[model samples]
Target: MSLDVVVVGAGAMGAATAWQAAKLGADVTLLDRGQVCGGTSAHGVGLVTRLLWEPPDIGLVAHSLDRFRELDETAGASFDYHDTGSLLIVGPEHEDEVQKVFRTWRAQAIDVRPVSPGDVAEIPGCADLELAKAEHAFFTEADGWCVTMDAVRAMVDEARSHGANVRPNTPVDRVRDGLVRLADGDELEAEAVVVAAGVRSRQLIEDGWRPPIDAFRAQAAVLGHEGNRSGPIVHDTPNRTYWRPEGSGQVMIGDGTDLSSHEPGLEPSVDEAFAHRVAERLRDRWPAADPIHEVRSWADLEAATPDARPLVGRVPDRERVYLCTGGNGFGFMRSPALGEGLAQRIVQKGSPVPLHGCEPSRFEEGYGTGFPMQEGFALD
Candidate 1:
């Protein structure tokens, strides 16, 4: 008997897709190059927020957050979900955009509020911020952060419970529409094949056909701070960085984003310069921040598309193939929702209305010309 769907890449997106697809009664097989949740999904700081508005993904974000909370409440499942909400700080220049976002959230019945920079210190685990030079700030206690790997594992485990076959350490050398060639030279056929292998999805996508996705190196650090690390997640737009409270006395900061394609296998460790620079930046608020107190830091490749939005759904010019990559940096934020939507589409369970601007067919016009990496989370 043939499988209904074969999902490549066992990361969060892949696992979520499998979970939904299998739950809907599709025969599913999810394959991964390494262990489940081992790739880019494992390295994320897992910032969950409705604060991101540029790409206009509020519905998806809301769904993902609900799913995260649901998983946390599940039996034997610990996603380490933290419901501390989130804050977005910007300079005077970005205030207009932030104001629009605030209004939109308010209209949507979100409990967000305009806050002065000094108020940020009041958040339980937040240190005094260097917002003396900042202009606009907003906060909503509805968003939160989570242990991404744990969330991913829970999703995968749920998928397994729903009868999805998961195979780890199984690398696929090639992927064709409705079929995949394993690294061991075996070929498996399915009715639908989804390539969610992060940046590498471009390579496994039917060989010569370029899918308009690129890879870039992003580094993050885990730092030991003096106070409790349970503050609302912060997005410092001016600094192009974001941070969240990480365990008991630690914080995680990210955004050493190298906006260029990272050559595979030439992975570089986090730069000492990045640690030093971010540490000095952190001291403006925390004061005792230091690179020497770094618990762990690492770098990994992140995916991006020309338009910054991800290509989710069936690939253009192909019937049996689909795509779920190139989310810029916000893929993990919407993983659960994305997976559920894609799974429903594949299983023919939802409305036929597409993701609008996010459909994969939009790239069919250019069809492979190299494009610069663009982060999906950006203001107009």
Candidate 2:
């Protein structure tokens, strides 16, 4: 069947886009070089939350959380969607900024409140942390985490149920105009094409057409504890680290540092040094927990934009060619809203969500010279 839309990339963003388009009655085809959700999406730490410093991101993430709830209710299985809440810990230096953000969040009607050291100690697995030394912390009961692959699977299955075609291991060499040329020398024409191929999206477009996206190597590892060590997702600003519960007794930690840009298609490998650093941070933060055992570690390429936001909307000067890349490592958390918004814009020519700041053409104005990788949330 001739597709009304062809979505390149089957990660969380692409899967959600295909599902939204199909639900809106569009004949959608989602393509991926590997199995669905097997890219960076599989390597995500799965920390989903709406506690963002950026005002524009707040709405998108809030909407995404609501969508996650909706999907969980109808998808017949939990995506391990846990509303365990989240904490953003800040030392004395950042206390004022954290307080200001807390006020803003409260004013926005978000369920966020200031927390003191005593309050922090009450949260599970945080009793022995050195957070008491920090000046302040903000806690949001509505913020939480989920299993990325579980959500991806539900999205893909729901998209397929809506009659969307899902093609796995079908790599695309390039996209010209509204046509997708596969690696196998086949071409498929569509009413519209969405490049959601993460870092690889840069390679699919014409030369000299920079998408303002860069890829970075991100590393993370899991640590197993002796007993169940449940707790809110922690974003320790002082250490530039974040950790969240993996299972009943395990926790997953990742480097929140801004890493250098990396080449696309590089084989994912774990860095022992990075893992060791995360382990050190975990030990410092949760001293009460039993000696940690490294269960696993992995590294993958994550995409980022200069503005720390995604490039959504139509590609400049290209008819029916759209882009939904450059997630800045928060792709999974933002995918639901991004996908729905992009689907609406493509199908109805307008979206309910305000996507002006995320337009692809924003880069044409030359926003900044060097990459702004350090601008967004460290754990993104």
Candidate 3:
């Protein structure tokens, strides 16, 4: 049977998309190459916050956060959301940039607050705080993270109950004549196709249509702690490192700069040097915490665009095909709002968010007819 919508990849974004589409009365089917939520969606730090510095992204982030708040009541499962708050410490080098963000957020009336070193140091696990030497910091008491795997599972379950079919270990080879062809000779016919295949999206395009997505391998370390710090998400912008309380006895520490994308088909692996470097940074920041008990890590490539924003709207060349990939590293955080917005556009025939700046056509229009590439290199 031809499905109303066949979503590729069952990560957070794909799962959320399928759930929304199915919930809205469309027949949906979700396909994935491996276990559900095994991709970057599972590996994400789950920072679900709308405290964005960019004005354009503020509404979308806010929408995502709001949706997350309603998930348990609507979707029948709690995604393990924790509103422990978050902090962004600014260094001398980033003072100007930080101030600019503050000014813009304040102008827009966001709940962003500028703070001093002493203010940040008072938070738990931040006793030996470096704020006194740091430049500035920002806090959003309303921010937090969702349990990544649980969120995906809940969405999938809800979508299935709503008549959507989600299949794992079903690797899609390509799309031909408006149907998704599998390697084992199965075909999925659909009225529309939405590609939310994380980094693997780089390879699933048509013969001539490729997105300028670069795969960056990112890794994070899970530190075990005894007590949950009521302290907000502890972050040091200069070190590109952040620590957030996880469950009862653990904290998740990740370095933002531990990113280095590789070519397509490159199996994700942990960068020992980078991981160790980040661990050292974390240790230095929080000397009170015990040593990392079990360090679990994975590498996933992010679809990065030249301008650092995602190519979120419809594909320019193909009318039936839509492009929802290239979320960079913020896909999970942006998925709640972004997925719902995409669904609204697909169902209503126009974007709820402004498409003038985010359209995939902009790349072709600005680049003069070349396929989207990273440094002009093709995905294959």
Candidate 4:
């Protein structure tokens, strides 16, 4: 059967895209090289915060937060959504930066407000944060976290219910124009071919266009606490570490992010020293989580573009080829919005206003060389 859309890479971005496209009545085929949603997002800290600078980024996250809330209520697609909010703790040294971020959020009318050091201690699992020394702190009410793998599975299940053909562990050999050649020699034709395959999306685009995305590694660990009082995500600005309550008696910690080049498909390695460092910080910041040790650690190759934002929508001059990758470290939070917008474009029913700045063709020749890679969660 001819499919209206063939989505490659069934991570959050691709799964969300396929689900929405299929829901909109498009005959969709979602393909993945491995398990759906078991990509970088599965290895993430699952923190969804509203700390953004660009209007497009801020707008998309607002859309995503709304969508996450909407989907949580829908059958077969619950994201295990949490509305625990987020707390940002800035040490005295980085007070300027946090102030700027707070102002940016306020300017956008984001639901954020200042929190005193004492207030930070009140949150569960945050009792012993050297309350007197904390310089700047704020809490964004809308931020939260989720379980990615379960969420993606639920979304794909919903897509299947809508008649989309979902093929897991089906590697796509090649993509061009409107045709996709599978690794096993199967061919599928679709009106639009969307590549949301993380860093690997570069391999598909390199033959026809220069990829502006760079792959780098981000490491994180799960620490087991004594109790189940883990929920809200806390970001410490000076250390660049962020963590939140995970499952019962467990919390997730992330910070060991670097821009150093890392190839995709390679087994990712977590720096042991880095893990210890974050654990030390956790011990100092939140005494309640003290004695919390690393229960597990993981690393994922995160992609970043020159401008620290994802590239979405159709590639200029490349008819039938649309891209949904280049997450720039904000992929999971914005996946639903990206999926919705791209699906609308594929179905030919969108002006795609939010994606105008993220168009793949916006980068001209040699665009990748001059621009330095931006840190994933850096506010500016």
Candidate 5:
């Protein structure tokens, strides 16, 4: 059956879009290259922090957070939805910049406040930590992590039950004339098509319209910290190593700067040297954490536009074709808002929130130059 809307890419945003669209009484079909939970969605750090620069974006992410709370209650399953909050440790040189972020959050009335070095130590997991040499730090009451894969699966299942057709292992080739052609040469026609294909959405449009959404590789080590007392997600700004408890007795570690680049569909290699460097950094920062044992890793191309924001809104010169790629380093946190904004455009013929800053047409109109290449890295 022909669908009213055909959504490409079934990651977090795609799944959320399909589920919400179906809930709004639209006949939707969601297509993913692999399984729904694969790709960037599953690989993300699952930080659900509402700290954002753009006010409109905060609304959408906050919406998703609200849904997450509701879904957790309804499903009676914990996606590890921890409100343990987030601590952004500041360096001496970067303290002012961090304050700028805090002031911005305050102006926006986000639930954020400054924490003294002493006060910061009182928070769960941060207690008794050495902060004498530290600069400044702030804590947000609105940040934590979630089990991304399970949430994506639950949303996909909910959409399917609402008569939305979702096909895993069905990667779409491209869209032509408002029709989406899958890898198997199968065609599905619809009045509107939403390109929520993550980093891959850039290549779906014609050549000149493509943005420089660079694809980069990033590897993380899920360390087993035998006696982690830290209650919140812990991050050290200077070293750029972030550690957070994964429940029970295990904690995960990833270097904020240990990201690499890759071509489309090419598997990523775990950098042993890079991993060792990260381990060394973590050891110095935490001091009491257990040694790294085994590691499990996967890779996918992550796309980011030049401006460090996502390319959302309609495709240029295409009737009813909307592009929702380019979440850059902020994809997972921004998925809820992106999905809602796209749905508003599709269902109501106009998005209440202005997407001018993130519209794909801006790239086409030369508002921002393109960094078109085989692949690039995210800037988060």
Candidate 6:
């Protein structure tokens, strides 16, 4: 039987898209050149939360959290879904702006509140920090992190149970005229195609039809700590750093938005300097904590668009071909909403969530350059 939909790239977005399409009764096939969740998803820190500054992002994350709960409950999956919450730490200089953002978030009905520096130490995992040096912090009760690989595996399993064909180590050379051409010269025709292939999505499309997406290298490191206290995910906006607990006495730290051009599909090398810098930052933030030691470090490529928003609609002038690239480094957190929205656009002719800002046609005129990394996370 002919397939109704063929999804390329079995990362978070593609896997979720395949599952949603198959659940809607479409014959779906999910193809990946490597193992599932073996791309950028594997490198992700798995910080899933709804505490975003932008209205659109807030809506997307809120939707994703709901879907995540439903999937965990009904799909019999364990994503290590935690509601340990998140803290947007800011210094005195950004107090006013953060307060404004906090009010806006509260107006949106998000369970967020502002915590003054005087009381910041009351939060667990934050007691060791130099609270007196900080100005304000926005705390959210519902935001937390999850294990990305576990979520991907669960979704793929559910998709397969729903009759979606999953093929790993199956590379597609290119896509044209509603046909997927394999590297080995085999061709498969489908009623529709969804491109969620991360940075490689550009290569699969015709030259002129490629979106303005580029690959950038990002790095993170895990560290060993002394205490077993699980702390809230903390974003030190002023320092351009973020860290979170990784189990009992372990933690992970990363440079915030340190992006550089990189070749697509190449394994990234860890920067020793960056790893050391992360360790130093941890010490600076919490002087009283046990000395941190680097456990391991990794690097990966994340897709970035001219605008920070993802492209999540039908490709302009491409018949039955859709693009869902440019995750902007938060693909795992936003995958559920993106996948469901894309599927709705294909099968139901409308999305349950608003995708106007993320429409692929936004780049028709010309792609913008230089998106400020700090804007998406409310650092600005």
Give the backbone clash total of model 5: 8
C-alpha RMSD (angstroms) for model 4: 2.5
TM-score of each: 0.93, 0.94, 0.88, 0.91, 0.88, 0.94
Could you give candidate 5's per-residue lDDT for residues 1-380 as a string of tens digits? 43398889888888877877787778999988898878887877676765554555666567677777766775565344667887766578766566666676777677777777778767777764556456676677667777778778877877887799988899788776578888788888988888888767766655445555666665566655547565777666677766666766566666646334456557666676765776677666666665654355444456667665677777777786877777655577667667767777777767665555777765545443234322111113
Among the numbered candidates, top lDDT falls to: 2
Model 6: per-residue Cα lDDT over 302-346, one tens digit each: 888866789888887788789877887777888988898888878
Candidate 2 residue-wise lDDT, 91-179, digit = tens: 78766666676676777789887778777777665666766554677788888888888998889888999999999999999998889
Cα lDDT, all candidates: 0.79, 0.81, 0.69, 0.78, 0.68, 0.80
Cα lDDT of candidate 6 equals: 0.80
Model 4 misplaced regions, further than 4 Å: 1-3, 76-78, 92-97, 100-103, 131-134, 351-353, 366-371
* Number of backbone-clashing residue pairs for each candidate, in the order shown: 1, 0, 2, 0, 8, 0
Q: Tell me how many residue pairs clash in candidate 1.
A: 1
lDDT of 3 by residue, 1-380 (tens): 32488889899888878887787777888999999998888887777655555666666667777777777566654555667777777678767766776787667666778777777666555565555455777887777777788888888887898899889999988864347888788988777788888777757766555666677766677766444455677666666776677767677766656345577577777776755676667656666554646456666766677665766667666766666776767777777666666766776666565533556777763332122433211001
| Residue range 218-330, candidate 4, lDDT tens digits | 88888886657754788876667888887788878888456777766676787768778888877777676667777888888887888777878887667888899888766
Q: Scored by Cα lDDT, where does model 4 land?
A: 0.78
